[model samples]
Target chain A: MKGPAISIQDLHVSYYGNEAVKGVSLSVETGNLVGIIGPNGAGKSTFLKAMLNLIPKDKGDVKVMGRTIKEVRKRIAYVPQRNDIDWDFPITVLDAVLIGTYPHLKLFRRPKKKDKEWAMQCLQRVGMQDFSKRQIGELSGGQQQRVFLARALAQQADLFFLDEPFVGVDVSSEETIVKILKELCRQGKTVIVVHHDLSKANDYFNQLILLNKELIGFGTVEEVFKPEVIKKAYKGQFAFMNEIGVSL
Target chain B: MAFIEAVMQYGFLQKALLTSVMVGIICGVIGCFIILRGMALMGDAISHAVLPGVAISYMLGINFFFGAVFSGVLTAIAIGFVSQNSRIKHDTSIGIMFTAAFASGIIIITMLKSSTDLYHILFGNVLAVRSSDMWITLGISLIVIAAVYLFYKELLVTSFDETMAAAYGLPVRFIHYFLMTLLTMVTVASLQTVGIVLVVAMLITPAAAAYLLTERLWVMIFLAAGIGVVSSIVGLYFSFTYNLASGATIVMAATSIFVLVFLFSPKHGLVWKTLRVKKKRASLV
Candidate 1:
C-alpha cells in the first residue's frame, strides 16, 4: 500500500561544463526523513537543484508521489542555504513568508486575505510570529533561518527539500528545524534534507543517502553508516571521528 | 508686473509645473527601490539610452514619446538578457549598452541635421514641458505606483534574495523583469523634467538621503518623495531667478540636499556623528 514519495531514475546533472551527478538513481518513501550527507563539492546541492528543476538535468526522470515533477510541483517546497541570501534587502519577515503563496496566485493577482492568514500561521509554527513585522535585515542569523523555515512551511507541501538548512544555524534554530522536520514526517510528509554534519545524521534522520559525486550508499541509517561507507563518502580528507566523534 | 503676470499666467507654465511635480513624485517613489536594488547605475544608462529612440523617431517623423518608450524598453530587456547570459559583469554590460545608445543618438541627430539642440535632450528645458508630456508622465506614474504597491512583498523578496525566493517558488524571473520594466518607464517619463544627465541625481539623491535616516522601505519612499518635491520647487525658483537651466538646477538642488543629509543626519550621518563621538571620548577622558 505504501509507495515512494520521491523517485529519481538515472539522474544526470552538469554544471557550466563538467558533469556533477551521473546516473544516480534513488527513491525516498513517504513519511520518511532522509538525510543526504556528502563532503564538499560532492553534488549534494546539485542533486537538490536538479530535483527542483532549478537546473536542467542532462538526463533523468524525477517524480513526486508516483507523478512526474510537473504534475506535483505545487506540492513540493524547498529551503536553500541561508548564506545564499542578501541580508540587506528591504522586506519584513511576514513579507518574506508571504512569497510562498505566490506560485498559487493568479497572474497579476495580489495576495488574498486567506493567503495572509496561512502565512501568519506558518510563521507562528516556526515561532517567528513575534518578529513578523520586523525587517528581515534586523534579524539574527538563527532568526533568519527560522523565517526561511516559516516560508517553506507556508507552502503547505507534502514533500520538502531542504539544502543545508542547518549549515549556519545556531543551536536553537537547528533544534527548532529538526523538530519541525520530524513533525512533518510524523504527519506523513516526505522530508529530504542535504546535511553535512556526520555526528547528528543518525539522530535526526531515519534513512541516509551518502554521496561523494556518486551514490555511495542509500538505506536505513544503521545499514548505511558503516565505517567503509563513511570513509568512501568523506574521502578521509580529515579525521572526522576524532574531531567530532564517531560517525552517525 | 505685467511681464511677470504674463509668464506666470501662461498655460504651458501651468502644465510644466504640474508635469514636474508628477515626474518628481514618481521618480522619488520608484528611485528608492532602484537605489536599494543597486541599480542606480543601470537607471543612469537606461535614461541615456532613450535618446537614440528620440532622435530616430524625429528622423522618421514619428511620435517622439513612442520612440523613446520603444527604445528604452528594448534596451532594458537587452541589458537584462545579456547581463544574465554573457560572461561580462552587469556593470560592464550596462556601460557597453550606454555608450552604444548614446553614440547612436549623437550620430542620428548629426545625420538628421535637426535644429533641436542637444541641451534640450541632455539638460531638458522644464519651461518647455507641455500638456501632452504631463499627461504621459501622470499616466505612467500612476501605473508604476499601483504595480509597486500591489506587489511590494514579491518585489522586495526577489530583490533581496533571488535564489532563495526562486526556491520558495516566487517567480523571481518574472518579478525581476517587471521591476526593470517599471524602472525604464519611470526614467523615460522623467526625461522631460530632469533630462538624462541630471535625472539620476533626482533618482538617486532622495533615496540615498532617506537611506541614512531609516532602514524601513515604506518610510524611505515617503521621505524621499517629500525631499524630491521640495528640491524640485526650490530648484525651479533658483533657475527662474538666476536665469539658469531649470533641469540642471533641480538636479543640483537634490544633490545639495544629499550633501546636507550626509553631513547632518543623526545616525550614520557623516558630520554630526563624528563630532558626537569626539565629544563623548573627550568627556570620558
Candidate 2:
C-alpha cells in the first residue's frame, strides 16, 4: 500500500541462447489483483518464473516488498501450474496444505498443532476443509486448484504468485479462487497471476500486464486494454480476444 | 521352524538376518523418495553402477563400501549431468552409464577369477557376510533413518514439486545430490545381503506396493519399511532352509508382495476397482 510491492527493472530471460522475455520493467502497487496475459508463446510463464526466481534470469533486478527475493522470500508464496507437479503423489490434502507452513517453521521443526488449525482455516476459506483427509489425486481439477489456493492462503504472505491457475478449473472453482484472491487483496496483500484467459482478465483483476517477450502495457484494466495494445502484444493474434467481444 | 532353529544355532545366520533386515529397512525408507521422485531407474542405475567400485575395492584389499558408494554416487551425478546438459533423456543416460560401469566391473571381476567372494558381491551371499559389513549396515541405517526424520519436510516438498521447493529458497540441486548420496550409501550398504544386482528390486517393490496401499507419505514410508522387513525375514527363511540364492529369493519375495498389493490392495487395487464397478452395475440393474 506504500511503495510498489513488486518492482522489476529491465528484466530479461531466455532459454538456451534464445530470448524468451525481453527488457520488461514495471512496478506494481500492493493490495491489488493483477493479471499477466499473453499468447501461448508470449513468455507469460517465463516472465513470472523469472520474477519469482524460479528460473535463471539473464538480466534483471526484481524486488518484492523492497527487498531481493532471497531476503524477503518468506513473504512470497508461489503456486505453480497444477500439472507441473505430480498429482498422483501419495499425499493427503491437509498434508499438502501443511507444506505452506514449512517456510515459517525453523529447520528440522515439525508443524505445531496451532499450524494445523491455521492450515485448516486456510482450507476452510477455499471450502476444502471437508476434503482435508482425502488424497489429492482423487480430487477434481477444480478442487485441486482450490487446495492450491488454500495452501497459498496458509502461507500468510504479503504477496502471492500463481501461474496459469485456472487452466483446467471448473467455473465455480474459478469463481471461488478469484473471490479468495480478492479477499487477500482486501487484506492488503498483492496477488499476481499469470492468466491466459483474456475473457476473464477484466473481471478477475484490477490491473493487467500485457506481455509478449516484452512489456506491451501495464496499468489499470480500463487504461491498458486498448485495441492497439492488445494487437501489439498479441502480434495480430487477438482473434480470440475479439471473439470475446471486449471493447478492445 | 528349521530356519529359526538354524538362525539360533549359527552366528553367521544371525549376522545375515540382521544385515538383510537392516538393508530392507533402509532400502524401503529411501525407496519411497526414489520412487515418488520417479527415479526408480536411478535406484537401479546406482545399484548396478556400484559393481566396478566393488571390484576395485576388492582388488585393492579395502572395504568395498567406500569404492562402491563412490562409483554409485559418481555414476548417479554423471547421469544427472548428461541428461541436464545434453539432449539425452535421463533414462538413456542411466542405461548407458550404469551398464558401462557394470561391464567394467564384470571384466575386472573376471580377471580376478581367484576370488570366490566377488560372485557373492554380484549375486549376494548373506551367509558369507562379515562382522564389519554388519556394523556398516547398522551405521548407514541409523544415518538414513535420522536424516529422513530430520528433513521430512524438505524431502516432501522437493519430491512433490521442485519448483515450489526452489521458490521457498530450498537448494533443489543440493537436495537431489543429497538423495543420490543417500541412495549410493544405501545401495552400498545392501551389497552383502541383496548385492549390487538385485538391490533395486528391494528398493522399488516394497515402496511401490506401499504407495498403492496408502495415501500419505509418512504412512507409505512406514508401510514400506514394514513390508521390506517382512520380505527379508521371509526371504532369509526360504534361503536358509532350501539352500537357494539369498538375493534372488529376497527380491522375489518383495515382488510377490508387490503383485499381491497390485491385485488386492484394499483401496487402490485393480481387483477392488473392478469389483466396485461390478457392484454398481448390479445395483443399477
DockQ of each: 0.38, 0.84
lDDT, candidate 1, A1-248, per-residue tens: 36999889999997665889888899989999999998888999998888887888999998879987767777888887878776666567887888788767765687889999999999999899999888787898888988988888888888888888887678988899899999999999999999977878999999999988778999999999888788877766658565776543
lDDT of 2 at B211: 96
Q: DockQ score for model 1, please?
A: 0.38
Model 2 CA RMSD to the hidden true structure, in angstroms: 1.7
Best of the candidates, DockQ: 2
Q: List the residue pairs that clash in candidate 2.
A: none
What's the distance in Å from true for residue B169, model 2? 1.0
Taking the tens digit of each residue's C-alpha lDDT, what string does model 1 give over B138-194?
889899889888887677656666665566556666777677677777777777777
Q: Write candidate 2's Cα lDDT for A1-248 as tens digits.
A: 48889999999998888999999999999898999998889999999999988889999999888889999888889999988979899998999999999989999999999999999999999999999999998999999999988888888888999999999999999999999899899999999999986887989999999998999999999988777788888765567656888555
| Residue lDDT tens for model 2, B1-285 | 778888889999999999999899999999999999999999999999998998899899998888988998889888988988888998999999999999999889889884566778878999888899899999999999999999999999999978878887899899898999899999998888987889999999999999999889999999999999999999988898889999989999999999999999999899999999999999999
Interface RMSD (Å), each candidate? 3.0, 0.8
Docking quality (DockQ) of candidate 2: 0.84
What is the alpha-carbon lDDT for the whole of candidate 1?
A: 0.82
